[model samples]
Target: MSDTIAFPYPDYLLGEHQFRGDDVRAFFAPGGLFAEGPIPAKEIYDELNASFNGRGGSRIELIREAYDSVTFAAAYGAYISASTKPDDVVILVGHSIGGEKALLASKATLSAEIDLLATIDPVSRITTGFRKPLQDVSVPESVGYFFNRWQQNYPWPVDYGSDGRIAVQDTASTFDDQLKQNDIRNAAGGTKKRGCTAPDYLKGFCKAFSGTTTTTRTDHGKLSHDDWIEQQLRNIIGEKLEARPTIETNYGRSVTEDDAADQVFRWDVRNHVFSWGEQDTPSSVELQVYREGERIPELSGEVSPSGSVDFNQYGLGEYVFSITAHAFNSVTIKQKVIVQDDDSSGPTITLTGPASRRIADSAPLTFRWDATDESSVREVSITATGRHGERLSPGTWASGGAPVSGSFSFDAQPPGNYVLSRSAVDDDRDWDGSGSIDDSSVTSSRSTSFTIYDDDTAKPTIAFFTSDGSPLLDDSHTESHGIANSVSWSVTDDSGIASVDATIYQDDVVIRSVQVGANDRISLDEFGPGDFRVELRAVDADSDGWVGDASERISSVRLTVTNAAPDVFAGGMYLIDEGDLLNLKAVGDDVDPGDADSLRFDWDLGGDGRFDDAQGARPVITWNDLVAHEIDDNGDFVIRVRATDRLGASSTSQATLTVLNSAPALVSIDATPVADENDTVTATGIYEDESPADTHVVTVFWGDGQKSA
Candidate 1:
């Protein structure tokens, strides 16, 4: 049964082909959005073959909406080749939005020499800004906005005092736009009044198996698109007669403006091996591909120290591509088959049941993935400040397995560090990938710590920083502001020391403090604000501790910080004037500019009350009130000279004046009565308000009557 060939575009797509039938092969499928819908066959279940909708807008417009979501399912997976392309094993199952539009139409018509995709739940959903599910803190604010680096720190059941916890808000709900073809028509639950037999079997498999096979997702939880494609095509030819998918995923390493042929994704990995197909017998001791923790760096395959593994690629979202055989020599046989796509409802961990609240800018570390698993995950990582600081991104999700409802998300982290459990593993590496450390289900791989500085940031030296009352200032100014400015900053890190938290942004608003030290000086005077900014946030206090929070660097803050700005600018500005000089500058430059003894001139018109204090520029503008107050006989006047130096560093210098109100006077209009023969008397004008009387630019020397203007 091999006779289809229509593949074109970037060159022979949809699992290309070189058949001979390792176990019945043939690939290619198109028509996910329309091309008539349904040539989407499958030699396997790792169903991936979409072609468009990288996101929603921009990013090349979601890769041109994943290039129209999958250009007829990638022209039926590149003309449905598949007579035998590497043990066949063709996959396409579709769930959430046609399983993420079949690998975005096999990356726009398959050709990377695919093996297994089998997606289930992916969520490139235009951009997944929010499509309903919270009803409370917007469901962890849209699942911590696409899996916030592995649930930040897990342990979230949420209750931060009600109406709280739900960050990641740029805002945008109502199912957030196009959303991967409306979540593959809602993971294929098929409704819209009925008619959705998986979209009429995807329009009868896009007009009777257009090519042969190619699919990104399939179904199970909420899948529809009426699937049965020939007993799932004998389970992709019986797992391609055992197994043998190599590798190739690629995502976070950057998919470039969301290209990779437009993304639909399922591409998660973890062992991904297979056996039979003619030799190399191993029989699946491990081969997972859950996918969804933000899609683990677009996983590829082939790792040593083990058996075989692969992951091709799928970028849009929602995933579950699986094939587990579980331990052979150790005797452990486990088989879990689940392929979905689009809705992207995997990785979740709860426990927010009760705990200190108040989370404004960042906190809600939300949790409760009773077990949510739809697939299309892309990024989740965890913690990992690795090097020796190892924790290698822990947290986790998929617990025991069940719940389901969109990946929720998280944040809080840093505080002291304790968090454990959660679970996602096989993150795929790089930043975290979260794949090992043995999860046996996490009874307590090391959870809950974040007490001190979970992650604020401030350290270079002085892990033992002190500040109970010595920041300086007997009147000297190194550390004196109300007596409670405690600052014991000790942030050690053997493997688990966690925090020292602190922030005193006077007028800024960085406000924080797990312990201000010296018996917690009221938590560092409630995070100070009257001319005191310590911010020595330490971390490594002990949280089963680790902090690859890398973004700002290290678990969170590796800013050994030299915020020590005492090389100069000592702090001194004092002045008070009420009526004498015209524009006596004083608005804002940064700090210094006001000193003389302290300069306090007060002539409240209510004068001399004993409440009158004096500093030093005393009685200096005496030109009879500097020209009787109207001032400026305009010879230019600008006397301003200040300096509080001695370390107080206030500096100002101004000197330029020529006031001669009575020096250039010569009144002689009465001597102009010499109306001799011509009869025309007029000559009286002398001005100097800073020298200005060009009087139409005139020069008249009455000696011979010469006028030039």
Candidate 2:
């Protein structure tokens, strides 16, 4: 607050007044807008003194007062530490060189409380020091940046345009070691990279900043230093703050509680010291109440110290109250609050106690009051004007919750709210029989509402289960082991207990039946078979799916009888001709003389054909066509052996006849007749079999018949 503290951004003011850079404007517009005329921070306001004004802008230094950076830093440190409260935050901003000071004033840049930051383009040099000035490269978490790029071709106003690089932002400067990203390249290349030089690193800052917000806004600026300032403010704050807080920057720079807007409850900021006691005395905290905007009433004990007191009791809009605590300036501390209200305004209508509630006709109801007031003796007499205002019985309102309880009941209709409240009653409610009543509003213990699920109430849910899988088929049998006695039902929307009667039907016969309660239980240790259709009749509420009762279908496992083979035929069979091989030489022709080949008979001859010795006689034999098998040389089928017993009981023992396909033989050779005088000969052979070979036999009768014959 002493000498002429120059701003580092003097050049910004010069450019802003005459020729501003378009890079500064594209931020909102594409060129600079607001006058960046001599943006100094020592005293918080800009002083524009006209210089040599011409088409080519006058050169000036964008500077600030000495110690500005250190002072801003100190102020920020104070604000964040022992001052700010939970659910409260502020955004600090500055343009050009002022922007530099603003950055310096960041306590969060070090302590880590300030959430967001934005700098159009902060000045920097390769040198590393606080005086060299740059964002703290150490902490680059939530910082946002936007470099005012100069338009390569067009200028603003008359010859107005910004294309070439005017200023460079070295975010990697060591001064910003704690608040900005480290630009290692700054150390490596000593200077900016050629083609890629457009403040792009700062562009990343803008992109990161945009993402943190829900709504987005775009702006443009010009070449002049007079670029948009409000847009920058909005970008920095986003939608986080309830209302934007603007710095009072006319001349001298200083923030006070009075500077805070109405939306802000309190504008309290602590220096580097945290948990500092605001006033000399400890904060007054206890059961103390006072009127809005009035001084806090001192508690019987100590009083919590705050700047002011206010509430909406004066009217309704909005009110803000904040306490200036005495924390002894500890780095971290604790605090508490106590509420004491003289809430008294005789039996004022609090609210209707279920004046329009629905109740089931089957259930009874009782009511109570919840109105409050504290002035004279109060009494509330309410009459039961039922759903349609039908006069209800007086005994229904009789009190009985110990001293006073009320009851209302009916048989047919459903439950509903009784119009029980009115502005005026019998007027003489000061005495409850003998004792004077202090309040009039009567509260009720009655039910609020009710609903009918189906016919009159919620139906019971009957669940059918089986040890078998679903899709009951005809062949499927409820296994002797799979039958179950358990069935379940749920009263999905019922006011009463659910009961069930499960009956199982198997083709009209009652296979099993059981009664189940609330949950349900049954055992199927003995049930089985037949087409079962289980019927579950529930007795709780009405059901939608089943017209009569809920149930499921089931079937029993199959019982099949398989024909077992009799001891008749053998396994190894041979094909034979019917007419050629049939009955064995039946004694006296007992067998038929027709069957021979095409028999295909399996003989149990050697019962187990896979043996070397003759098989035991007692065995089964099979025949594809028994009638076609050879009986013997007679072509008959049966082969019987007559046994003459000692007692003369002559019985014929029969053995199964088997046929074998024998390879055919050459039956005979026929020779053709020869002529009597000349030499001529002819010959032929006969063969019959499934497969026969060629015959080779020759005879020649020379026409000299008498000698060669």
Candidate 3:
């Protein structure tokens, strides 16, 4: 184990150094938010430190956190610069956003190499509108190995429908190509409350034991506190183990020791031979054999130069053999061999039922076979290979006697090509004339193959792929309106895709539908003032001729459809006298019958093409403010009103507003007493008026409302 650790932010820093009252209260007071919770950064640092503290290495622990990308890089670089010492084993671990920040810190420290990097759902609340999901956190090329583990929170809703931590791909190098292991599991307390368990065999020099350390809980934050995960990390740093020698046991089944560690190996033969090898095996080695958990050795001795041991003298029971070599340090190769008292020769078996034929997965399949042996058939094994892949029959071994026939019923497999094979073994083997069965003369029959097929169960996937064959994101823009838009779709299935049906919906109502086979483009030309939902449904074409229906699968995308323009009509021409108020109204019509109330009306009083004002359904225009540029013309003002639908579709209508001039009205009057006028005396007066015709008329008015002209 090496000493040195890094974390983001030390809450203890505020309490111990800053002496903040709130921080002290939260750390020491009771009934606070972190009273029993809140595993502070310092605590994590201390816990990791205890694992490698006295192990003898230069100790260094650094912790900090910054939200700004620039500051984050600077802080991370400072930490890496501090760890410039040679032979430094850097173990980086973080939780939540800190996990992502930790990885970023490693990425920023390009010159540093990481021995182990682990993360628990690397996530962060995007404040800068720039973020990488957990899935986007690629393992640094310089990191020796990475372990990414995340437990889905309750409700298990992925962020943006993406659980970035499920698997890491699209990195500088393939995740499979890197020395890393990615594991994701649902937290206990969700649909399936299963606890997290580490693999039995560790990777590199780490040994991860399989055990339960915590009960099922919905708190996703507890993953960082998971004792199992922490213990694995501790083991990786503190309890590193050297690689062990490989051992295998072959008895009709080639079973490797790694595959069946500490498992009982059932042996029915009278003799057993063990072969072993090591990287630097000495000329001679000691082998010890014991019976089930016994310290006293049942047998211990040195074998010849060859590393083979026979156990024909042993009786039926459980036995453990330990082989030790000087090359390995304190690592003993142990094998638990369980010998059963069933030494027999294998019998000959033949399949009598399920002749080569096509069947549906829902249908029941019956397998019949005959087994014959001179001594008596003991067991029969049935196996199968299918189009989906090869599969072993559930409980393939069955008990039977010589010249016996039996049948087993099973559900049909998914659609694919398949081959079924069977073999049998007899109850007795060839005896060595010493009242013992000869292990070298075991009886077994050659396996025979038969063809059987089941209907395809996979449904075709419908993808709205681009020209390069990538799926289209939702609400993608299209320029075609009332014209064909390029729409490409493809359906995939394990079996061949039969037919695909594409449909367009306007506001959930089906508008157009067509059939497209295999890979083909269907033109979508639905035009209206509503949203569009394009759906593609597909079904698999099973060539097995199975009599069962394959359900259709569907994928769809929604988009906004541009609205068309509405038709506007203004009332016919109207004449109004000067100073007389005139009102003009315009009505509009739309192809979308439902958008009548949402239509907007605009009026252009000058008929200059640019709408002056927008109003409700009806817009009123008064001729009082009307100015006639051409008085010699018709004195007609072309008032235009435009109507637009909700989707920006518009139309305009024009009407003439004729203004008529009234008779001249007296604006002013002036009279001069040129001569004294009384009843017929000469009098003169001048009157001013506003009218198209310029003229002067004189009239004299007497007292008492009487006028003379």
Report the number of the highest-TM-score candidate.
3
TM-score of each: 0.16, 0.24, 0.33
Positional deviation of residue 349's Cα in model 2 after best superposition, in angstroms: 16
Better of 1 and 2 by TM-score: 2
Instruction: Please give the CA lDDT of all the candidate structures.
Output: 0.31, 0.31, 0.51
User: Which of the numbered candidates is closest to the native, going by highest lDDT?
Assistant: 3
Give per-candidate clash totals.
187, 154, 16
> Tens-digit lDDT track for model 2 on 585-640?
21211111111111122232233332222222222223322322212221223333
| Residues 1-709, model 1: lDDT tens digits | 1111211111112333333233433333222323231232343212211111121121100111232443545554554342224433444433323334444544443343434333332222233211121222221111111211001111111221222112323334211111122122211122122223453355342232345443333222222232322223223434444443322222222122113234342223332322212123334433234444332333322223233334323222234322222211111111222222223233543444226533221344444333322332223333323223445333433333422323333342444333434444222221112343221211212233232233434232333233543322222233332334454443344433344445554444455544443123323444432444445444333222234432211212111111111111212132212222332322212122222224333211112232122123333443334444334344454344343422333444343444443323333333375787887786766533232321234345666776644
For model 1, the superposed segments whose C-alpha errors exceed 4 Å read 1-23, 26-66, 77-90, 93-99, 103-117, 125-709
Give the range of the ten consecutive residues with the poorest summed lDDT in model 1. 144-153
lDDT per residue, candidate 3, 1-709, as tens digits? 1211222221221122111111110011111111123345455345444533333333344333444433554576557646554455565565555555556666666566665666654454343211244455556676555666554443222342234442433344423211111222221111213344332112122222355333333233445455445434443443223343333333323333233365555555445666555444444455667655443243566643235666655545576666544221222356667766565445667666555466555455666777777777656655555556656454553323322576655453444566655666555643232233233334454443433444455677766754345566777653324333455776788777777888888778998898877677755443644667778878777644344546568878775545567777877686876555556667777766555667788777655667864455454443334533222223566777778877677887888778676555555554554545453454443443333333455556766698765
Give model 2's TM-score versus the native structure: 0.24
Any idea what lDDT model 1 has? 0.31
